[model samples]
Structure formats: C-alpha cells, structure tokens
Target: MSPDRSQTAYAASAADLAVRALDALRGIGGTAMVAEHVERAEDPKAALAAIRVVGADTFAPYLLADAVFHPQDAAAVTQSFALFPPPVSTPDPPPAGAAEPWLVAWRDWAMAALLARLAEAEPDGVRAPRPTGAPVLTDPDHSQVSDAPAGQGSDSHAAHGDGLPTPDSGAPDDSGPRDTDWQRWSVRMGQLSPLALPGLDGPVHSAARAAPLALARGATRAVLRRDFPTAARITRWLALLGAEGVALPLDPVPLLAHLRLHGGGPRLALDVAIARRLLGLETV
Candidate 1:
C-alpha cells in the first residue's frame, strides 16, 4: 500500500497504530525524533515507534496539571531568556557585591520577545503584588476603632462646645505661658497632630508612640497574627509614611514577627514598600 492512500483496511489500522505510537511518545525527546523517522520510513513498524516515543514524553505535564493547579510550565515558558517581559527584571539588582553591570546589551533583542510573551500571559498588565486571603480588619470588632475617637468630643463637635473651636485650644495649655501663647492652648488628643504630642519628637519617638497603639490594636488583637495581607498593607503604608519623612513604627523585630505570623515573601519586600511609600507612590 502506498503511504498516502494505504486505502480501506490499512488506513483505519494505521490510524489506530499511529495513535498508539503517539501515546508512547510521551517520555523522551530524542526518542520522539527517532519515532518520526520510523513513522515515515518504508516500514510501518518504524512509524509506530516514533509516535510512541513522542506520546510518552508528553504525559508528565498533563498528569501534573490534573493533580494540582500548578502554573509551572506557563511560568517556565514565559520566563525563557528570549521571551520574558521587560518588567520581570525591572530595577534588576546588581550581582551581589560586584561592580554594576549594564543590562543594555542583554535587553536589546530578548527583551522584545520576552515582553511579547508576557503581554500574552497578562493581556492587561502585570499584576501588582497584593495580600492574599481575608482582610485583617474587614469585619473587625471595631470596638477599638469606635473607642479610639478622633477627638475628645464627637467627630463633628468642637472641644468645649459649639462648631469649630479656635485651633489654639487644640494645643496644650501651659499654666502661665510667656512667648508663643499658642503653646498654652489645650490640644485635644485626636485634634492635634499625633506628631505634636507632648513627648513625640524624633523618628524613634514617633515610632514608639504609634508602636504601642499598633501593637495593642494589631498584634495583641490578632490583627497581624491572623491576617498576612493586612500586615502587608500596614507595612506598605508605614513604608510610604517613612518616605514622606513621617515616622512610623517599623522596628525589624515587630515587622519580622508580623511577616512570620502572617506568612509572606521576602523581608526586603517590606523595605521596598516603605521606600515607595516615602517617595509618594500610591499605596492603594
């Protein structure tokens, strides 16, 4: 029978044999190449061998996908040197302790290919990192929030009484002030800037002030303990605050403890968030 039209009986038989050959091709690469050689060979047995090899080589990934929702192949294919996205290595770090290496050459051709694949993988855009799982305080008891009123009075009320009280009243009222009478004003707890609190001064001081409250309201209350995402959100917030020269309670001990409890990647990620925050980057 001719290879093209082995006609009636042989066509059906060959197709079945071909399928079996393909199935067996799942395990080895060189074997599949050899199998293709066999399939096209004058001998029918040769063709079957090639297809078998190819079939065997292909089953592992199929079986794996069936077992777990792993994106390993997709990640691998996308991360190929020639097909990765530009953003994948943005601000790529310098090799540890070595002189800075210029990436212009490495980025020349491969970058375009990589970006193409990345675009296909993420049609819209690369997703920003986000905390996975429940919001730490989504349905928080909020008893604390309710208790921690912004001002001594109500949100709308002035300290002593009436509408907007003089801003001076928001300051501390010293017994007998000399210069700067404004210093004599009695500032309400939440009315005045937390920074201006009596002893709240330097970076460490501000950190100390907020640290206790955050710890009390956060750690002790299982805020950072139960919710990693919330902890990350707080880390990002504090980082940005630091950039603005605003002090934050971000000692490594508490930060690491939060991360360890909540479970997230890289301690340095927190540092990046803080840097971004300080630089006026949007945390939202």
Candidate 2:
C-alpha cells in the first residue's frame, strides 16, 4: 500500500489495539493481563511497524511510551527510535494552525527520554550530550541581538534561547503570548531544538533542569485558553519527566483527564491514561 494508505490502515489497527488494551485494563484480568497482552500483541519489529504506520499522530508517542515504560524492555525502547529517528538537522517550526502540533513536539521529547533510558541501560551504547552552552535563537525577523530594552529581553533569551520561533512572529508582540509561550516550552523540553538524543555522541543526562513553575504556568495558560490539546500534550511531557523522578509544580492528572474527556478521542484518551499510569497517578 501507499504511505497514506498504510498510515490510515495502521491508524485503524492502532485504534483497535488501543481499544483492546483499554479493555484489557478494564477487564477482570487486570494490569498483569494487560501487560501480557501488550507484550504478546506484537514483537519488536511488528510494534515498530505499527508505530511507524501512525507516524507522529496524537497516539503514536503515547504508544511508544507505554511500550517503553510498561514492558521495561530494551527492545521496545530501541524500536521507538524507528518512529522517532535521529534529527537530520534543525527542523523548521510547525506551520501556523498546524493540526496536532503538540504531537510533533511530544515525539521529540519522547525520543529524548527513550535515548536517556537506553544510555542508562547500556553505558557502552550511544549517549547524547547534556544540553549545555548558551541557547541559540535563530529568527529571520528578530536579529540575534534583541530589539527589546536591555535587561528586558535578557531573561527571555536567557531562559529559552533555544526556543522554536513562532509562526506569528510577524503578529504584534502582544497579540498571542500563549502561542509564543507554548513554542518556548516545547523547545525547553527539547522538542525542535538541537538537544541531541542520548546514545549518539553526546553527554548523557542532557535534559534541562527546567523550572516546574514555568511548566505549570504554560500548562495553566493553555487550559485557561481552552487549548486542551496543547495542555494535554504538555501535561504528558510533565508526566514523562515525573516518571524520571522530576518533581512537577502541579498535578497534571486532572487537566489530562479534562482534555481526554473534552475531545481527545479514544486513542488520545488511552494515551493520557497510559501516561498517568506510568507516572503512578490514578487512571480512573
């Protein structure tokens, strides 16, 4: 089949697989059975194939995360990279009003996490360098030198010098802080930036020690704006961080459920639940 047709087919199969996984969770067999089924459902290659079929769609990263966390298996983690291959170069920013931009961001963060896990598991394997050096912001319109009054843009640039540029950079500066904020948050989480994956030729443990308050602030703003998809996506990242022992400024579970209920669809809902469970949060 063609690429598009294959993606459509994988989406359908993944949806069915998610439904079965959810049912297994809800069934009398409980978590152990769910784990068994998740393992038995596909081997490494097949699972990777299914994940690739979905591409960067909303549920793909979540499925990969589930495979990484629940199975606690190296093969699952290794296969995830097939879907989230190494960045060839700095990626262009997401298009204006792109459908599910959050998913794209999530894929990058998820890959970074997977690489970190792999490095930890196998010290001799590939390892990524920790994010060091000043962040390099490259905006075509905004010169590397800030136009803002001295000390004003200092913190903005210092805090997220590596942030992805907003599509609406041409808009009035005050027009949409939320959009701008989300872009920076995505970059800080190593979304589009050049934070190389671990197990490649860099330092291990390179994730930023981002302030919890900043993450909470952006998530709250996304929630207030009724941008649940963005909120949910960010919350998912926070949960991933939390799984790695990072403390969060706030509990993202409630907001995650809210998004899952509002309109996240079955696949997204399953993804949210899986993320919560991985984080030791209640998933009811």
Candidate 3:
C-alpha cells in the first residue's frame, strides 16, 4: 500500500476504535460507578475491566491511583498498566492545561499516589537514581516553588511538597520513559502562560496563555509518543476545566478528531470523543 493509503487506513481504524471506546464508556453508567468499582471491588480483574471501560478519560488517573494504592492483585495491577499502549519514544505533548496550576496539581497528586502504591507493592523493586536538573513542579498561579526548603513556609511545604513522583526515588520500574516524557512535557508547558478561563474573574495573566493552543501542543506531543492513555486523560481534563469556566484557546472537538485521524489509537480517540460529549462540546 502507498504511504498515503496506509495513513488513510490507519486513520479509519483509529476512528472506528474511538467510536467503540466511547460506546464502552457510555455503557459503564457513569464516573461514580467507575470509581466505586475501582475502590471497592475485591477482584482486580473486575476492577481492571471497569478501568478498561473507563479508558483514559478524566476519571482514569483517580481510578488507577486507587487501584495502585489499594491493590486487589499485584498481577492485575501489572495487567492494568499493559492496557495502556507502550510508552512511545516521542509522545505528543499533553493537552491544554497540562501545565496549568490546577491541572498540574491534580496530575502530580495522581502520579504521587501511583508511585506510593508502587512503593508498597514491590518492596524490593530496583530503584533508579534521581535525575539531576529535573524541573521542579510549581503552581502556575503562584510564584512559590513546591519543593522549597522546609522552613520557608511550613504550611505550603506541608501541603504540596513532593506531590509529584521523582523518577529516581520510587519508580515502579527502572524504565524512565514515563518520567522522562512527563518532565520534558512539563518543562515545555511551563513556558506557556497561566491557563485561566475566559470571563472568569481571577488573576489575569498575559493573553498568550491560551488554553486551546496549550492543549493543542500537548495533544500533539501525546500523539507523537503514542501515549494514548495520557492523551485521553489530558483531553478529558481540558473539557472539564473549560466547562468549569476556563477559556479554551480553540475548539477541542475538531482538535481531538484531528488527533484521532492522524495518530491516536481507537481507545485514545474514543476517550477524547467521550469527554467532548460529556462536556457538551459535541454530540457523538
């Protein structure tokens, strides 16, 4: 097949996958039920199934964090990780708000929670050395650094210190791609303006901090890396945050569709579509 034909075929396959993933998500009832299954299920397989249904949507990190921290089965936990595509060597950047203070905070919290779980699951897992010159996680709205020394602001330090997982300290495995990719993305995102919503009364940053533009860059990076799970997760958050009054720099539905057509797999594409529907951004 010609390169163009192959590309077209791949897009068609991805679109079909996105549709199926959306259907599966809709059939799962709602986020409340998905969270319940992850938190209360006695069987890891059942939880994993529910998670698969949830895919990389907004609630994924929450559900995954719960499973990671409170493992029903170690093998199941490992399997759940596999449900996500392998970490692409060149992941597309995260969707808009990837570096927004609120989103970053949430992402860091979820990552930290997962790392903590990994630490508990494998007491003797091989530890990787912490990378030097790593980007420090910061609150975009505030100038305060999260990793500040203990005495500077005890309260702030207590609240946000090390919320992000350090790759060298407590990684689930020796593979550094996840951390490396995430760090690189974070640094890129940090260069953007604060992700404040339109018409919302808050600390105004420069107009350059457009949400849609930021998200577009993020989605592209995520797609490049074939990190569909992260792509889906970021898309959902973008929609949710936009609904909560954040201004989007661009229409997300078309952007998501573009990603679906270009590189994202079915599950990832479907996840974005589902988020768009839920946010009333578009109808499936």
Best by TM-score: 2
Q: Which model scores highest in lDDT?
A: 2
Cα TM-score per model = 0.20, 0.49, 0.35
Badly placed stretches (over 4 Å) of model 3 are 1-21, 24-216, 223-230, 262-266
Candidate 1, superposed: residue stretches over 4 Å from native: 1-225, 249-253, 257-262, 265-284
Off by over 4 Å in 2: 17-47, 53-163, 166-170, 173-184, 187-208, 240-249
Output the worst ten-in-a-row residue range by lDDT, candidate 1: 130-139
Quote the lDDT for 123 in model 3. 24
Question: lDDT per prediction?
Answer: 0.29, 0.42, 0.37
Q: How far out, in Å, is residue 22 in model 2?
A: 4.9
Candidate 3 TM-score, true structure as reference: 0.35
Residue pairs that clash (backbone atoms under 3 angstroms), model 2: 126-199, 127-199, 127-200, 128-198, 128-199, 128-202, 128-203, 129-202, 129-203, 130-206
Q: Model 2, range 1-284, lDDT digits (tens) per residue?
A: 67787666556656655564555433323333223433765343344454433323322222433422343433444454544454443333323222123334334444444444533553222222222222223233443412110001112331433334443542333434433533353324422211222122222122222444445665676577675644554555566657667777787777776777677565556546555655765443
Over the stretch 1-284, how does candidate 3's per-residue lDDT look in tens digits? 67776555545533443343354444533333333344554443445544433322323323222222223333333454455322332222222212224333322223223433443543223121211122233333323232311101112211233333343333332333433323333323322111221222221122123234444455555556665555554555465455666677545666566556654455555555555654664344
RMSD, every candidate, angstroms = 24.5, 9.5, 15.2
Instruction: Report the candidate with higher lDDT, 1 versus 3.
Output: 3
